[model samples]
Target: MLLLELVETTQTVASTRSRLAKVDALAHLLRRLDPAEIPTAVGLLSAKPRQGRVGVGWSTVAAAKEEPAAKPSLTVADLDAGLDRLLATAGTGSGAERAATLRKLMAAATAPEQSFVTGVLLGELRTGALEGVLTDAVARASGRPAGAVRRAAMLSGDLGGTAMLALTGTEAELDAVGLVVGRPVLPMLAATAASPSAAVEATGEASVEHKLDGARIQVHRAGDDVSIFTRNLADVTHRLPEVVQVVRSLPVRDVILDGETLALDEEGVPRPFQETMSRFGADAVRETVLHPWFFDVLHIDGQDLLDEPLSVRIEVLERIAPAHRIPGEVTADPAVAERVSQDALAAGHEGVVVKAVESTYAAGRRGSNWVKVKPVHTYDLVVLACEWGSGRRTGMLSNLHLGALDPTGEFGEPGGYVMVGKTFKGLTDELLRWQTERFQELEVRRTAGTVWTEPVTVVEIAIDGVQQSPRYPGGIALRFARVKRYREDKAPADADTIQTLRALLRP
Candidate 1:
């Protein structure tokens, strides 16, 4: 299919607020794709390239300025092959090569095509058509059940591959896709609850386990060969030799385990998240050694446990990696679950995850079966600026640049707020409209993407916590920040101090 056709559909998808409309448009486009074009089409629509990061950045994209071609000429295959060329280079002096290659490709695209390519290269295709929408599209196009398509993609850990199957293969063929001991399936995610009691109340009988503030891991073992994957499915087997050795020591010859790995201090207490990230975020070795902790098993021997209940999966996990199992208790009592949360906190862990005892693993999606409860800290912060939105939120002020009161002038003028992070979450349509109107009146200046405000707006923000950061002036950043509400009752001076935020960071 022509890239322009896909680009037009993307515009339509982004223009619509109704998810059903987006799905319909995408499904129609998917039905017209040739077999060879399926993977590229799915990848582009999903806003992720199958080749992964190809070393292109904003600088590379900005330099690729050229006049648009009069008519469409690029094919999906053409762009895919060009991305492959960009991905081939690495090491020193690769940036210039990548930039040149990116320019060449951009020069060939029309104006709309260039815009689409920019989104793809930058990984910011905010079309409101991610995997969830695309999965429904595939099911619609292929006349198959959405659940079947979703399950196939989850089990294979490849939406591109799943799209191909749905378009070309039979229902039996899709159903045949099952747990492969050596392949990493997407890890099951948890929904957030207000508290442990609330989560246990929702799940009835549940397992409340410590939710480690560390990197997520999915380990796959077949015979003596072992591979470890990050949450995003990146193979980090070489970066974690210790994790590999530990997985190899498991009694089962063929198994897949879902867990976390983090560095621990001398007292066997979990280190700060930054310390854990120092060990995890780099390819090169650091001084800290990360230890793996297992919480659930997806596959054991030839038996696939994904369809089994969490209770059954935990049984297999406990039997195999008894030493690495995360601390948890099986209980129907909400008070007991609350006690478990306290224990996890006292033990230096993040918090507790309350999981339904009878729930099966729902990969690649956050279901209600598992709920994570974490202590939240809310503070009155100043809105430094706002960024223009995309997709359904186009032409509206969306992301809020949050700042904290620097009362002591340690980082800036006394009473001036220091920028920490940005968030667009937890904003309703009413809030978006209000922000767009209110921020325009408060705007002092404008940039290409952001509208700088006078920092007069006081808003209450809730955060999972704070993390040490070198980017922020106050040496801290908010984690999972969301706008609770605009605090019209409070003034800028009454906002939470920067020290208060920094204090939430671990020692």
Candidate 2:
């Protein structure tokens, strides 16, 4: 199929707010693709390339000076080949070479096609038709059950591979794609609960385990070879030799363990999330040592336990790695679950994850069988500015520039607020319209995208926690912050202090 066809399908998908419409548009596109183009087509639709990060940044894409062609001529295979060449080129003076190549590619594409390709290359394509919607399209086009396609995709950790199989291969072949020891399966995700007792109540009889504030690791061991993968299935075995050594030393061979790894202090307590991440991707010169803590076992001794219940998997995990297992207990009692959460926090951990005892592992999807509970911190912050929105929120004032009151006169002048981070989440259309009208009235100045406000609009913001930041003036930034509401009754002086937010960093 031509690249223009896929680009048009993406535009159609993004033009709709209804998910069913997106699925229908994607399914139509999928039906037209040949088996050879499945991988590239799926990758482009999902806003990822089959070759992965070609090192083409916004500067390279923006440097393309050639005028777009009036007609569409690029095919899917041709586009993929061009990206391959872009990825293969490296070292000194490759910037000019890449810019020239991108210009040639864009020159061949039409105006709309250029925009779509630029979005895909820059990883900014928010068409609302990514994995979940694309999976449904694959199922619809292939005449297979959605559940079967989803399981295959999750098990293989490859949507493109799953799409190829479901479209061309038999149902038996798709079912044969199960958990392999060397390959990484998509780690099961968790839903959020208000509290541990609420999580326990939601899951019934549960295994509440300590949720550590660390990088997630999925270790796959076969004989003497051990491989470690992150939650997104990126192989990092070489970067995590400490984890590899621990996995190699395990008593059982041929095992797949799902766990968390964090750098611990001299007292053996987990360090802050940022401290752990500082060494997670650093070179070998780093002094921090990451310790692995396993919570679930997916495979053991050549037997796959992903289909088994959590109780069965926990038994195997406890038997093999009792010393490194995350602390927890099995109970239906809400009080017991609350105590486990308290213990986790006291041990310098994040919170707790309550998992259903009878639930089998559901990969990729955030199943209700598992739920996480963590304390939240809410503060009255002042809105310093707002940025122009994009995609569905185009032309609206979105992404608020949040600021904390700096009363100590450290960051800015005596009583001026300091910018911490930006957030556009938790806003309805009504609220967006209200903000567009109100912030424009309070606008002191304007930029290309942002409108600087008078810092008079007091808003309530809830965040997971604060992290050490080098960009913000307060040396801290909010994590997962969202707007609760605009506090009309509160004044800027009555807002929370920067010290109040920084204190949340303490364990």
How does model 1 fare in lDDT? 0.84
Best by TM-score: 2
Task: Tell me each candidate's TM-score.
Answer: 0.76, 0.77
Alpha-carbon RMSD of each model: 12.2, 12.3
lDDT of 1 by residue, 152-262 (tens): 999998899999998999999999998887788888877667789989999899999998878898999998899988887778888898899998898888988999999
Q: Compared with the true structure, what per-residue lDDT tens digits does model 2 show for residues 85-134?
A: 89988999988888878888898998888887776665445444657889
- For each candidate, how many residue pairs have backbone atoms clashing (under 3 Å)? 0, 0
Clashes in model 2: which pairs?
none
* After superposition, candidate 1 runs with Cα above 4 Å error: 90-100, 377-507
* Superposition TM-score, candidate 1 onto the true structure: 0.76
